[model samples]
Target: MEVTDVNNVKIYNLSCGKTFPDWLPDRKKRQLLKKEPSLKRRIELIQDFEMPQLCNTINLSSNGEYIFACGVYKPTMRCYDLNNLSMKFERCFDSEIIKCKPLSDDYTKLVFMFCDRYVEFHSQSGRYYRLRIPKFGRDLDYHPPNCDLFFVGDTSDIIRLNLEKGQFLNPYQGSSTSFNCCKVNPFHHLLVCGSTDGQVEAWDPRIRERVGSLDCALSALTVDPQGIPAIRSIAFKDGVNLAVGTETGLVLLYDLRANKPYYTKDHMYGLPIKSVVFHQEWVISMDSKVVKIWDRETGKPFTSVQSQYDLNDLCLVPETGMFFLACENQKIQSFFIPSMGPAPKWCSFLDSIVEELEEDQDDAIYDDYKFVTTKDLEEIGLNHLIGTNLLRSYMHGFFIDHRLYNKAKATSNPFAYERYKKKKIAEAMEAASGDRVKLQPKLPKVNQELAKKLYDLELSGDGSRKAKQTVALLKDERFKSLFENEDFQIEQDD
Candidate 1:
């Protein structure tokens, strides 16, 4: 199916089964008048949101319920509630905001970076902390599970900060030029940074050392021999593949195991890529001219939408397959893309029922006994084997089936009796076949004196007749024959 935009509406070219009937009214008919479910097309407007200031960066909460945006010109940070489609709060900053990110999963705290080398931290309760750093950070990323720590990339270095202690840690230095972007791979626990020298470097934060690096310049064409294209944006797929965007309007896909980019594409818009987002099967890249979605496997453009204003950032809501773009015109636009595979069944009806029941719970009697599904157990953090079994027994009045109890008891032994039993059986089989060895083979010991002489001669670089005679004495026929005779006698006894 092809989805296109016409007069601010999305026109979907859908296929119905049968053709239209002759009696259909032309004025009342849709774009495709079909009587027997033939091919048809229709227009739809899914969703949209407005912004009060031009947003340079946008971040969505884990639950996809709140949006945090900050930008320059107005230098304001604002939060929007997706459910109500309204602004929650707006806070103005002194310097132009370069980036805004939530400090935690619950969104209780937030971090903002300003163009004037100031980093600000704010909480939901209106408490805030501002720190002046050595240089302006171009990009920032929080530690996956630790809200107290974050990494910021600046010109020539990446710095780590501890918010809880209000202290700066040792800076990770490697980039020869300014860093344009940085990201943390939660799955692999890697810190990645993109530099103006057209290099992407991955660091092992635990060791405080550089682990992997890639030169993005090789992926793009160069006109000036000395000029290096700046890496503008970066995104990762499953912690194994990295997508890098450069100032030369080229997107390079690099496999973490390979030293070079596996795929490269010169963007059709030919503008610097402001942001890149990796969907399940598509790579969504946006810049000043347009937002383009490319087939991830083929590295070909699947679809693109032209924008009148420059796009600053793009975010994807994985749960709904919806994408949001923060633009230069003080607007946030959203679009829905159909999944490449069969869509999963949504539980909206069940969710609505639960919400309704939750609202009137006070009127209902609290039942001591309740039927619990697997999902309920998971929600309450009882999905493990022991927890699940305990919950099952409790819900069933502490009575478990005899067979299941026995199975669980057998499997729960810490010594792993099952493996022990298999090992014993294998040993017995070997004995029955008379294939077991009565004695273990011994490894030959090194000749220390001869080895020392050879080492000394090699280091001395002496190739004289005296050194040759000494080497021949070390390989004396009588001594070699004595060792060989012992080995032959041992093999004969076996």
Candidate 2:
């Protein structure tokens, strides 16, 4: 127990862990084991706000008061008030908004980098100023230290613009032609850019050329069929440590003092790593597949979360474990990972909420339920199990109460679905039964012309063949059944 003598006050915190057995039988010694074998990462869903379209990027204001989500459907952008957790307003654009950054401390002053060769400055009222670049802007960054706007894109150089004098400053020549991501390190005040040619280049404004780690982060990709890898995201833990994410699902940590990387980690999904950031003691990375939080020292995954849809980007909520994720579902998802850290000061109430969640027992949404489709019943031989305790029907599927999915899959025929399909085709070929539902069961498709001709022959219509066609069809045994069968004959009434 920890005690604080603030003013000769003896206050006890019952929440602190005690060395006594509370949940055990009295007078008996039983080692209190962990309720779970692994870390119980209770990542709660905090927000699922709707967006205009696919949220290509997400950014928060310098004060963490507002969030901006933009995408390419109509080249639209939506702003949300973080304090109230409600959307403030939406603004549409002519060009695709690929990147966004806050020029000033608040959301009122914002600059957007378009897919075309344009950069637009916007305020709460409307557009304030506009600037044109030589090449299409891929990413944007703002350096408060120099009060300059950094733009990287299709060209082989980084553009520096002065906001005070409204003029373009000198550019930093890079090793690659196209740059994808740009950032300014808070500790070193160095400008870093991730390029399309898989190089993470850093620059000092005072120098004409690059200064920091000019190494390729995609050097470890050895898969034969995989193509070239490009750097997609870059994050800074400190001035010395840099985390680089590539399009080929690789993350490299580089120490600025050396040319070599400290270590390299792969996401294993073979997808483009969308975002990678350092939070507390963990390195969080998100791909198109899943979000992974791993240890900074051991490089082992702490926990993972599978996104509901393909992810486009991720932004770490400032000074908190909560994060906002942008995806194609026209909605942004935010999850609070308790292990990352506690809630921020603005929302300290979440700490008790998390504690309550830890002690609370959660029931499955579908308890003892298994979802089985129409094909699953036939393939898994669950017809007999439906009415019994083994299976229960719900919605459009069956739930297994007695047998597990693995056991059923092991017992049922793996080729049952194929056999069932063949049997269905054979039944369809044979005319449907008379008692078949009045709605008319579907039959195998045949030539409409041939069916019409057969019907004409049955009725002795004008189209009935008189010589060669009649003789040829009559000799075929297949036609004999069609002509003689009462089911095939068209009858208007009884």
Candidate 3:
């Protein structure tokens, strides 16, 4: 997918036809519909509120059933009930509501912080309480499975609050960098916090001291499966890993036990990630109107949302598999995650090859290759190489070059490569033992019809002359004759 700016608005250009699986019988859906009418794609405008005040920060409740938004000029917090998309305007003494969370069983009760210095709790029973502490707070996380408490932190210290008793415990002391994010381990008493100065500090609230520390922060923080701060925004099959969003719009996931990140993607957006969240399966982040949801395991974004304003906060409500998005424009939107059905059954042969390629690439400095499926190669006239021993040699050479080689991974259910493997071994043994090494045969040359069609593209009196340069890239070398006229001209039935 590519984003291009025309005039002042950004237009998303999707290259849906450019895919690796070109061989399946019914796979070329987009290409088959070439002459069909174009479809207009528009973002769903769920709801909008014109708040001239303009908000800079937003937060959602733990369960994602309520929205809390605040801006610089606004003196009070705005609360929106998600039960029926209703809203209530409430006044507050706090200068700014920077963070908020649900404190009790009833969704009506809430706890929000003002200027990171004061914590205010408004109970459903019409009672309110405020607590002032020495350090400021950045993020609030409520812990459930282990302790009946919540955690918040500033630059140098973290505060643990017992919500049931409405009390604050001794502050957990740590580094001096301001904390940018924090999360509680639901299965343990550990509290993890990431600092603006690139430090991750982990502490057990019961011990009231620091237990572990790592470097790198300013993105999202989460505990891994071992209940360690090894990963960030994404979850893995064995453990939770950290998905670090840098200022350059690159997303990376680091395993806690490893010193380096496992995967990295330059998402190419120019906005800083304000908040990142992960469900059991996906990682979600904010980037203007497009809320990108990436598969935690694959590091690929499968879906996104298009909007007019930047998304400041996002949360996944696991009970319903629905997502709540709180925009900087003070409007909250919720959408159901399209059911992806079940995990598609994969051919073990292809799956193994793909995994091997990924691992080899990660461990070595090989070039990246764009591989096409057997069907695609066949259409381009390269199919005979599939089962030849020469092909295995070619794959070995490809591995030596460290390029991607998952061509047959998604095809033919069982991905039967045994036939091809035997052929390749025979050819390789014959060649390796000093017999003549026959180079792979080339495909039939490009036809005159296709060349003329390409040439017409050059002189069609349209703005496609630039396209002609790429037509030269057609795989069939024999097609070049169509360009005989060098400077072809149009003739009106002459």
Residue 306 in candidate 2 has what lDDT?
A: 69
lDDT of 3 by residue, 1-494 (tens): 23333323222322211222336456455554463333222222222321325564555565555656555455556665655455555545536767667665545777777774877778765438777756676667776643444444545666667666656666667674456677665555466676655566777766566877655432323221211122222222233466655443556666767656676655556455655666667676665556676787787666666666666666555444355555655334445432322111211132343345447655444235443455555553546666654333334231211121343433532434664665577667756876666454333243445555655554333333467565554545674443444344334467
What TM-score do all the candidates reach, one by one? 0.59, 0.63, 0.50
Give one digit per residue, the lDDT tens place, for model 2 in 160-226.
Answer: 8988878998788787878998888987678889888877887886554687555564354543237
Question: Model 3: residues >4 Å from true position, as ranges?
Answer: 1-52, 55-73, 78-83, 88-94, 125-127, 144-154, 162-168, 217-239, 319-321, 334-494
Best-to-worst lDDT order: 2, 1, 3
Model 2 CA deviation exceeding 4 Å by range: 1-48, 221-228, 362-494
> What global local distance difference test value does model 2 have?
0.72
Tens-place lDDT digits, model 1, residues 87-121: 78878877888888887664578888878888888
Q: What's every prediction's RMSD, in angstroms?
A: 33.4, 22.4, 21.9
Count residue pairs with overlapping backbones in model 3.
Answer: 14
Model 1 scores worst on lDDT over the 10 consecutive residues at: 341-350
Of 1 and 3, the candidate ranking higher by TM-score: 1
* Top-lDDT candidate index: 2
